[model samples]
Target chain A: MSFLLWLESTGFGTFVRESESLFAYPTFIVLHTFGLSIVVGISVVVGTRLMGLAPTIPLAPLNKLFPIMWFGFAINLFSGSGLAAAAASTTIPNPLFIAKIIFVLTAVAVMVVLQVKVFRDPEVDDKPLDTMSKALGGSLLALWLLAMISGRLITYIA
Target chain B: MNYSHIHIVLNHFPTIGTFFGLALFLYALWKKKQDMQIASFVTFMVMAVLVIPTFITGAAAEGAVSQRPGVNPALVALHQDAAIVAFTLLVLTGTFAWLALWQYRRFNAPSQWTVWTVMGLAIITMAMMMQTATLGGEISHPEIRAEGVAEVTAPPEGEEGIAYALQMWMVNNAWVWPTGETLHFTGMTLLFGVMFLVNFRLLGMLRGVPFSAIHRFLPLGILGFGVTMTSGVLMFNADFHRYVAVPTFFLKMFLVVVAGISVLYVTIFDDTWALGKGDGTALRHKIFAVTNTLLWLGAMYFGRMIPYLE
Candidate 1:
């Protein structure tokens, strides 16, 4: 509790919370939104393909998307940190916020599993996607939806 | 002149353009002229982009006209309802027309089923636009109203039927606004992702995939746009006063129109559609792609900044 309060009291945190400058709080929020759009948006697109929406799109080349998704994740990490630091005491203890974190983490894990078991397969383009990969894809989409819902709700419910 | 003047000037384009495009499309189909078909598709797409500004400015026009002593509020409401239906159908027709052109570029001919689908949607949309236009005329032009028609008594306060109830539900419920926001955010992500994939391909990434294959996913972007527009309308219906006065809101809307037109450009224009695996885009295509991407980003920025700017 003390650590969280201390984190919130830091100069950076104070600036994020109190500064009238658009660059301070709003920029972080905008970056967070852009990051969310990139990561979850790309994931959903790739995930839907794996779940059998557009089979003509070869799976192997989609491996190129992971780096972009990671770049988005990196943006989210920094922006999210700034946001959390600004209200550490309230956010850290909020169950909705905690759930959002877990949802995002689990979604990322599912993305990695798809990357390895699906995209990395040597015969991925030649063979039909296995049932396991399809299930993973479905789960990935569901997890991201939950993450988005929980993240949005935190603003209101918390 | 304000938005009302702008609305009147721009409003005739969608109805007239759709009728013109539909006639040309049918004539092309009869004559088997692919070039004419493409021209009609372009017409439909341009009308779609123009309709965004037309529909938005209608709200401003409503505010202006509804304040006049002789204007009937009930007539305005009825016209708005019809306009909503027409607006949605016109946009759908435009999308189908765009897909038809994209098909033509990819396969050397648009699919028979898609061609028929566009025709069906365009026909229905044309009818809706005519109905909306007539209702709008009746709002101020009593000369256009049917002779001896009964005066429309404004419904007692708080009794304007389903639209009023829905708006109240959105306002009265605690969860409604946040839920709309969540959906809006999700929709934005979906929209952004698809736009990124398509525009980046023009910007030279995703080279292994043919433009046609990525083109198949444009409907997903459209689906996202539909979700966002629906949720956005719900929010606006609930609290339009917050939006109407905000300069950032107007800027965001203007960017949406530009981004929308840019999407159509990449859809039908041969420069990007002809791109195959390992193909490099022209410099102009690259410039358009970058502009489209920035327009979307600007829209998102202005939309997010509305509260602060206000």
Candidate 2:
């Protein structure tokens, strides 16, 4: 606790406490919140798609929306690190902090697998759900949702 | 009695309203019921209804906050100004959405005009949501004041100096901020749209599309994630301390990570999705998709709460 207090009061901490820059602080906060929207928003579509909600649409075309999801990921990565720098000492120890890192690592891994196995397969049609594909989709959906719920809990748990 | 309180609540109303609508949409999807779909659409449209009142109330609140103690004038002003832009975008997007829905309901099949109109509205609404959220951020963080100046003096030596210098550099470089915000919005739309699609598929709504096909969208999802991450870092680099300290911030980040990991696991090890084979993976997709939806909803809940809490 003493260390936490000391860290918060240090010169670096003071700058965070006292500095005024529309771009530096506010921009990050905005981006962070905005990132959440993207992250969750895309998860809704992808997750729902896996569950068989919109049958009329093609999965490949729907994949067109992936760029946006990646965009959110990119935003959070930088924004998240910047935020971490502010209070590395405290944040490093925080349970939420550890969870976030682990989650990101796993999410990216899942994404990579998705790319290699599903998207790359030329034979697979943008047609309908089979047993295995549905299972995969369901799992992907769960990963994203868990990510979101855990994200929200960060606010309360800490 | 406090105008600020009123305005904050008013401005925030649409955001909450939109979520409620989305929730309804999710519920509809879950039940595989058309009524729920209609109800959800109606809920979403309510965003239009609340937009004007939110703006008016927000304006009033801004005026009051400027005069109050402990509130930074610059921050209040920034919030007020950005809010106006958000309000304008919301109103425009809401109108388009309403018209699209109207056209959708009245006609046997949606026309090109209506389709384009609805698409356009969705795009615009997403953009506005990004701007509105950004402005909301300014309300709390005076350090990020748009004036491109900082109150924190530079620290001496080592990590502190580097951090301070970086923060100052971010302030001095003005061009990046606007562009960053724009990119953030683009990423936001992509992410939201794709996520919606994923959720829709999981609930057994889109039976025709192969479950494997959903994986194709992952690339686009990644792209959106990229944009969001880039902009996010710029902000974080500038103000590491406050954001790190904020409780909700940590939570949101954590949830995002979890969502990402779940995506990976589903894509890799799961052997359940065999398109139209012996059986369909609908049940599995449903369960995971539902869980994903809940996680995101939780993130949204906490994200919204960040501002109101101390």
Candidate 3:
């Protein structure tokens, strides 16, 4: 708790919370949003393919998307940390903020399972995906969307 | 009642109608009833088409409620932005459903693949509808607001950036706002139509139509993108502060970057080039096509969301 308050009182935090300039805190928020869209958007598209929505589109090349997905994560990690730092005292205690974290973690776990267990499976190209992989793809989307919604709701309730 | 009131009254129909339509579609999917699916597609299609007015009236709603006491301009902006995004997805889902119906009517029945495609789109659209509804609920209902969420403070009265001549002129002129908005929608429609053709082709729909044939129409969509990009900037310059303060606008700009990158990618790396009937496209290229389509739609979603989420 002390740490959060200390961080919030820092010069950076004050700048974010109190800045009138468009380029300051708001730009960070925007970057986070884009990072999120890329991460979540690619996940949805890849997941959709896994579920056999686009059967003719072969699975071999999907390996290329992992890097793009990671790039989005990097953006989010940087911007999210900055955003969180700016409002630590208030944001840390916020239920929605907590919920967003939980959702994001679960999404990450699901994403890992998707990347390691499903995408890396040797039979991915030859056989239909197991029912579990399909279900995980759907869950990944749901969790990330929940996180985004909760994060957005923070502004509404606060 | 004015536009807002009419919107409030009519809004329930689309939201409720979606559930009713989805229920029917689900029933059809379960029973494998082609005819039933066709009927439900039409139902979904009608529901999607009806949302257009609600979306247009939304600006009017903003106009009406913006000045009312206890109304937060930021909340209204967020709700409006969220609504536009949901509406865009709804439009895409509806158009896809219409195609499904056409497939059935012309061919005597759609393939299993077509049914699956429709189901996938419906699931996505339903999710968007729920998101949109939730954001809309937050506007007047503070009780529903997430705990500890701060109300967005209004920025200063005036916001002016570098101010290009035409952009400044449009922003200053009241008449230009609506004109820009109308053009924005027209551009959106043109882009969506082209996307439908291009994306569906990538997904193996319109198989008889060659990739090169569809390639010919890329410029039309690019033109639409260009139009919207210009209009969007004008709109932004018009009310710089509201948009800048709104987080969603920044997100929209990011999506535009994604869309722009995808356009560059497609021009250079679209693996479908030189492909024809009986010629297969590379998997990587198809993935790029799909990604680009979603990126643009995502951009559109964020663009509309700017006002409400901002």
Best model per lDDT:
1
| Per-candidate local distance difference test | 0.84, 0.56, 0.66
* Tens-place lDDT digits, model 2, residues B91-148: 5544444443443443423355644554455455556665666656565666655664
| Model 2 stretches astray by more than 4 angstroms | A1-18, B1-191, B194-310
* Docking quality (DockQ) of candidate 1: 0.71
Candidate 2: residue B284 Cα off by (Å): 41
Candidate 1 lDDT by residue in tens digits, A47-143: 8887887677778888889899999999999999999999999998999999999998998899888888888887888877789998888898899
Maximum-TM-score candidate: 1
lDDT of model 2, residue B304: 42
Give residue B105's error in model 1 in angstroms: 4.4
Residue-level lDDT of model 1, residues B165-197, one tens digit each, is 667999889999989998998888778888888
Ranking by DockQ: 1, 2, 3
Runs in model 3 with CA error above 4 Å? Answer: B1-310
Q: Candidate 3 on A61-84: residue-level lDDT in tens?
A: 555567767888889988888788
Q: What's model 1's overall lDDT? A: 0.84
Error of 1 at B97 (Å): 2.9
Error at A100, model 3, angstroms: 1.5
lDDT measured at residue B222 in model 2 versus the true structure, 0 to 100: 57
